[model samples]
Target: MSTDGVGFGVPWQVSAFQLPAEAPGAAELVTRIRELRARILFDGGRRPDFRDGEDYVDDQELDFGAWHFVGRREADGPPVGYVRLSTPQTGRLFQSRAFLGEGPFEDLLTEEGLGTAETFEHSRLVVEHRARKLGLGVHLNAMAIAAARCLGAKAMIGTSGTADGQDLFHERFGFRPVPGTRRYVERYTEDVVLMLYRAARGAGEYTALVEQLEPVFSTITVTPERALGDLPRAHGRAGSSAVTIPAPGADRRMDAEVWRPVLFEPQRAEDRGELDALLASGQVREVCDTIEEQLRELVRSREPGRKLAGAELERAVGEQLAGVDPASYGVWAWYPWSGRLVHLLPREEFRLVRTDRNRGRIERPQQRELMARRVGVIGLSVGSSAALTFAMEGIGGAFKLADFDDLSLSNLNRLRAGVHHMGLNKCVISARQMLEIDPWLDIEIYPAGLTDENMPEFFSGGHGPIDLLVEECDTPYVKIAAREHARRLGIPVVMDANDRGLLDVERFDLEPERPLLHGILGETTSADLLDLTFDQIVDLILTMVDRERISPELAASIPQIGKTLSSWPQLASGVALGGALTAEAARRILLGQPRPSGRFYTDLELLTRADRSTVA
Candidate 1:
């Protein structure tokens, strides 16, 4: 009856709703999803009772506050795919935590002061073999992500199967392997991986998907009002014993004016007894001794191999242990983007991993100089990637962004976001992506998009005067309009067109009166082209960029702009490379290095010609 994302002459109607276990067709839908999952997971129909039994991992209790998606060829047809998002409480009882024991999940929730009321679980995602090519998996995941965000959840985590390589598929939607929990599932028959996606707090594969599919997501996601209702209690409460999660608002960071030793415990108080028993055993003693010995050796390696041995070394070790408390040993800092809790190390020590590689290349003073500079980026379609690369590499201390356009389905082919972010301003989405990378980072946004009136304010120091500008807008008016302001403000400009690696750099700082685009279009000022027709605009852009030298694909796509294709073709790889190239140029320019303004091409086809010559 519908054909939203269907192909191959199959009209698939995708419906999203919270189906009560007692609903008219709920039981049958669950059976179809379960039977399909069983076949996929175990290679046959594994009944509910058998070890390799049917994957009927569903029930009403688990569906509380959850959204279920069922895709069919017709109104009365069997489901081609199904995916359920678990409610907050049910997410706490997620299988990965139940079987693998609580890890950073409990720690993460503790640090954020979140409860089951602010979490989600992606459970029971299955698609029939025949429908795999119809793009149903992407639709289901996108809808589920949107639904979770709608229900006021901050993050979603779930267990994925490694047996059928679903882990890789999950990565496409931005789900990453939970940092420390990877092990066998159900008596070692299959490997299970815990995956998580924190809504904001970093750029990731899934975040982009969410942004790309935002339009579709807005239509399919069910709201919490209709999804949550009276249902059976959760089957497995995650933390019911002594080592339980404290009720929200209870202070665990301190007690009686003393720092409490935080522990990564998410089980019941009774379960602590089992852990105490294990800690008391000879086995644990051996493990502790092994770790202590390794620590001693590490000190020796760095401390000129100072050999502290015999009673003398034991005395020193005891002295060192006496000054430290057990609680101070494993305090983890949570990184919400990756759902990883990294053990806190010295700032310099932790940063050394990247700085060491940059030492001789970037030099210490230049590294420090780069981090102190403020940069602004426009046009988040490609600008998002550039901004993130700058943040990840510690290239900028502050950032300002501008974009009036909301995320559309077409943008997802490159931008990092999910269905939940659909309809959001591009600037807001990019800024969120940047902040997720570094919460302390200072970022400003221009929601209304850049204009003649605000262009001056955008260039001057509002947050901080931008030392560099990465212009990536598609509007020819803004593109030229931005350079006019940058030239007057003496700011360097860098941009990449994401085709044939055409990077156009304008060093307005050096040549204040230099003709725009190196005078390629006959001294035409931004004002001169303000009233051009669409054909004139297209002709101006083509002539400015030298269409004769562009790649064959780009040249072909240009003339068909409003014909076969709605827009120019762009690949993720090209956009990513453009980001890296722009960052590299910006870094050099910011450091006062010799990166004078000019056009540069890192054409893949041209570079490969040398390789082909060598191969031949």
Candidate 2:
């Protein structure tokens, strides 16, 4: 019933990684594993004919076409244990075939009627001495099985030494001897046994073990397929159509896992052509340079009066950027709409502009609480601004965005986008802006917009339920329609009028039976509001928005629809101000602060009054 930060049911906090040989920390990982193995395997007098170094036996050649998983405690610590899963069709299970005599492992598999195509090999499950007693051995084996399952392996074959009771350990963990493969060994003066554990695709003797490992599987999964924009899981043995390359403009989206490696991969390959061309155009350099400059400013603010020489700053920032692996972050996201990369990794100790300033104001724990909140935004005109602000402050764990409208030229005055995004969907544009700020923030797009047919599903908790709903739609029907779902799900609803900064907070979570919109429209159903005339709709909106307290300009401009103005007046200033106010309110409400159901005004007229105090 207990869980760690990542929801893994382990004795100690552990980070499970499946990294390639060329991954950022792969070299250090390889060295650590080798050292640990040497300390344990050769701690005695010496192993017989061990060709590897006196300290460790590192089959570095085996690293090719193999995935390595290293387990570390408390993140940022030395690897406590390591395992390797290799999906090979031709190669024998490392020196095991010779011991069993003339491909005996494969013959044994054939005799068992299990094909070798869907089979893989797991080996080198070594754990450090200090870390061994904490149930890491069992965890490492469980995670190795998880990795095997993730890679679509139906079974695994390996050889274990009998000297340290490893063979007994493997047998205890569902690994059975290959009937006649147990034999005395000359390799290390220790007996060895070839073992087999069948994952069996969907059903196997180890079905219960697989079922029990569900939680660990979900936690330690390395979703390379989903991470690489829309890359399909590659199948087939070795060379028979085992790879697929994304086409042009297809690599626009990049999640945290895929973004870093995809970016660092050289541009000469045609498979990486989209990014190759972009990098050649000098975009990446320009972007990283701008980010580095901001990081410098952060350093200045963090330690006032401290400065670095121009050359020294460049070298320091350059090294830091090189180490900025987006895949190393806790949260990551991909936004195809705006074509940007986002991750939560800190470089130069500067995450965002408010790093030092927000330390005392918001505090790390408070920000973490805010980040754990799941928010849904239903309208992009104002909701887009709110989403962007929330992302800038890292205030949402995930987001569900719904807006059916496309970005037209007229929307540029209020929406935070340039002319390049003119024809894109409003939700997509908002998502892009949010992702550009923090790509690791999870986002779901309702491209066709929210409807009654899909609203229930939208509010459902698959990843997690919508914690709070921000309703900013102008359509009278949707405004009430969204609240109906919010009320049913007990989700708090926040909306910004973007005029006089009227932020409406409906604490449906606090008052579950509270009437939709506090019954202000007198049970105004969506169907009933749909039949009203445009003038009636205007009157309904004004009544709901409290026209009595609206800004002088907004009040004057509301009634002049079609006569003086083309539509209800909306200003860039008002929209931006509404975004800032709504974000602040949402953070408080999500944190369970005392923001009860009410309409609060951030009226500029009242705040910047002529009789205001002259304090600078």
Candidate 3:
């Protein structure tokens, strides 16, 4: 028997056990193991016969092909902690005998065994009280796992007695609970928790967890203290102080500290200079008061955040600026009164309003009638700009948008939205902008692409189809689908394409046969030209069209450059003209006025030329 004492200068050791016949000192070691177990159970837990005379060493069935790891200290020259592994067939914890008549173990084991033939069972882990806090348990456990892997086990399974212990083991060692076993255990049973460890599976789970946690760590908090320094300062004489008032549309209730720095600060020197100029011009006080009046009227006029349109806005502005100089006041005259800044309005807004006022002005009755129309546009890339133009013109109408692509960084060059809108779906971003321009517009959205499959559903065919279809999708498939569908339903289709600074149009209603434009472009198939091997189709088109009618440079670039002018500025110009012409066509069609029905193209290049035929 062994009589090694704890904390008595014992040398700590870790080793694996082999069959006694393979080791010369096996007999003596077996005797020492028996003494160690007796002393551990008797002194540590007041329980004897813990092994039930099983002579674990003599149990060759358990030790012959299995591995046993023991942690020892020289002071006690005996095992202080140990973990054992055995094939599923030999381990008592997993054997059919240990679970016979106990519950559903037979069926579970049978199912798991079939599903995972490469897995083994771990059993017989015990630690003496002296070794409990010395890391011996963890050390022996790891060694047993390494041994199991060395023997080619792909997965390890084990059971834990307590929920807390099971949670700790799985949390630290990367184990997952086996599902669908709650009904198998008795009401008073110890609730055995089953776990498995697969190295590859563990690695994948670890990666996903890290990805989920990264966003949490990367979040930044913006505070008001940082915002105060960024507010625009008014310019003043050397001895005079400038008193700056919050602009009319500004939400004073919002804590200036939170959004002031990021949202109010001018990002460029020119912006600061402009703000100072406004202050030095002695118009700052009047502007601030005007802004206040505009804010009060806006609040009283409609629901908060709702945009104003048509007569409502004209009347609001008229009331706000009853006597200001329309010219010297600059474009920002409306900034102090409205929540929106003056420059935010499209340049066309001021031009259109002034021109209409000068000409035979549209009567209030006629304006109300025009606003009653509804228009649906597909492909927000260009369609959104068109929608904005129509809204600015006081064309009161229900507006619908359709597109599936999200706003990306590349869109900032031409899109009316800013960086905050990046990653949002285009339909939503555009719809919000439209509503901001004219809240009265009955806005609807389909955040999806219009395909041949869904075109019928998108256009009302049973009762009454949409009055017009504006196709702006750059894709050939969408263009063909939209054109063909609109033609069949007898709905006039007004579509636009951008080439350099020019806008190309194909009016189906003017000449019903003109819907054949899709055919002329060879848009029968869905394949994109971008995916083609060569520019044969484009070359053929350029050769077919009159040389004098198109730009010589553009003609030469077609086969080589294809359509690289699909940028935002080019597209925006096209959409703006398309919106203007489309609204004109709608007015002519509804008013029974004479209008051109065939293809018409407009470009800034044509305007620059002295010869009008260059526009053809």
Candidate 4:
């Protein structure tokens, strides 16, 4: 029945025993009972001969089959502790009657009264003295309770000796003595305490108790005691009697597992031995398998159609890249083995395919190579459209995009692309669109746009300064600023004003001071001019275009009417004509062809006019 001082490192087996059927055998069952009693009396230091004449076994087996729980240090080792249970029995044995002294048993068992029905008696819990302080008593008691419940007992009753042990049952495990019970057990001892545990009451009460114990059982440490003010002083006063508080700062402090990489300095080579040992053990493999399983589940949930193949897939991916201009194509390489994607080259490295077959000189060339030209676009709206057109035209050179507004849903109506590009700043989006058109095109993105703060940076110094500044913005101040800045920086500025089917161009680089077209329009500061209400600006432009009106059809196509011209058919024609005229002006500037240096206006209305010269 003893472990013989065996160390605690080895595992132990715990088993449950069911009482035998039929009449008790004094030779076999009584012998086992005596052996159990001897173990309890000799090793556990309990009174010898606690039960006589097979009375305990005879009563338990006949009335209600008794179940025994045995804990052994090894598979074949003897029991170290045990507890007994009895089926429902009325009268003196029932703690309810003993505690109450006088009770209508039927009424006492109802919810209107004591709220108890069937009850079992818990008796004879004993542990070897060596295991007494080691939780064997607690273990045996818990086993008895569990066995009682398993046997369909609705309640459990017991009496405890008036000693310190009774306090353990009452305080630690929530068992309470029944009221008015001193007289009933006076025969045994005046101090004997009667206790009853209604299974239903215990079940409901324990649910809440278990809830309170859950965090403790789960080992979840909340705020650390050190993090709590006065905790140290309180602990010092209590000394050994104080509840053991978890280490100060231990619970609240960031867990090294989750946040060490972010907060702690990297471990030195000499300090990683423990980590290396952990990895060398099977722990690292387990963690990796868990992570892989989670990742596989995630991938299956999100992209069930995507398959990860081996080297053959890599070869296939490489083959797919054939004929793709490495410079033009944004090549993103994915390593299937590692699940990482890397950008293979800078976006600008791609060489644009020369769409123009005619390498020789052509008269009045409509296609101007952007490579030999420096074009600065002042706004990404009309400017972005112009840049894309210039790129598509194989104007293979440096182009500057300047705009402060980020791409928004409103811009999608006239601007290229869609909602996928909503959040990007116009300068970035326009530059990206140009790169997509001709990756070899030189692009300069002015994230701040053409403000006076960044004017010099875009115009004269740093990287590619402006050669031809295009003022596509409707801002009059920007128009003035662009012209003045370009003049001061010795760069040309071009701008297109789309009015109905009319594209008006002001070539400030060619004619710096011909009263600066904005000046000719009698507008000085862009802020002052754009301050005119939207409707007012539209009305003024309409008046300007109407003055040189050639036909009503062309006049109606102009955006000078604002939202009134909501017809897509009309808007599309105007935009196409505007883009064409803008492109033509850009071509003229880039080709060094004879063109108006001050301002030029092209009217689609004049196409129907017999007097084209007058309109021109």
Q: List candidate 3 stretches off by more than 4 Å.
A: 1-361, 461-464, 500-515, 518-553, 560-579, 610-616
Model 2 stretches with alpha carbons more than 4 Å out: 1-356
| Residue 263 shift from truth in candidate 4, angstroms | 35
Q: Which scores higher on lDDT, 2 or 4?
A: 2
Clashes of 1: 22
Q: Deviation in angstroms for 358 in model 3?
A: 9.6
Per-candidate total of colliding backbone pairs: 22, 3, 11, 11
RMSD of each: 21.6, 19.6, 25.5, 30.9
TM-score of each model, in listed order: 0.47, 0.51, 0.40, 0.39
**Taking the tens digit of each residue's C-alpha lDDT, what string does model 3 give over 1-616?**
1111222222345555443334665544444444443444332111222333433121223444455555664423444565656765454445322434334554555655533345676755666542442345444555556556555676676655331143344435465666643222221122455656664454232334323322422121112112111222111211111111233222222112011000111333444444554445332343322443443344334343456666766666666445653322223322221233332222233333322432244544455555666666888877777677666665546665678787888777666778766776677776656655543345555555665434665676211246667777755556666766666666666655544333334455555665345345544434443343344544443432433466555556554453564322343555566666666655555434565555566656766677755555
Candidate 2, residue 108: lDDT = 79
lDDT of 4 by residue, 1-616 (tens): 2222112222323345444444354245434543554434321111213333322222223222444455544544445555666665333455445445555444445633433335677765655432332334544565456556655666676767542234334334446666655331322221456665655555332334333332332121112111111211111111111001111122121111010010000133321332343234232222211222222333333333566456644444455445553322343322111222223232322221133332343221334444667777888776776777777665537776777787767667787767766766777666656654453455656655676655665676433466676677755567676776776665655555555444555555556565555454564544555467766665554443444643555455555344665432324345556666677766766677766654455655656577755654
Residue 200 in candidate 2, Cα distance off native in Å: 45
Q: Mind giving the per-residue lDDT tens digits that candidate 1 earns over 491-603?
A: 88999988889898999899998877787866667788787887888887777678887789988888798999887788888899889999999988988888878999999
| lDDT at 342, model 3 | 35
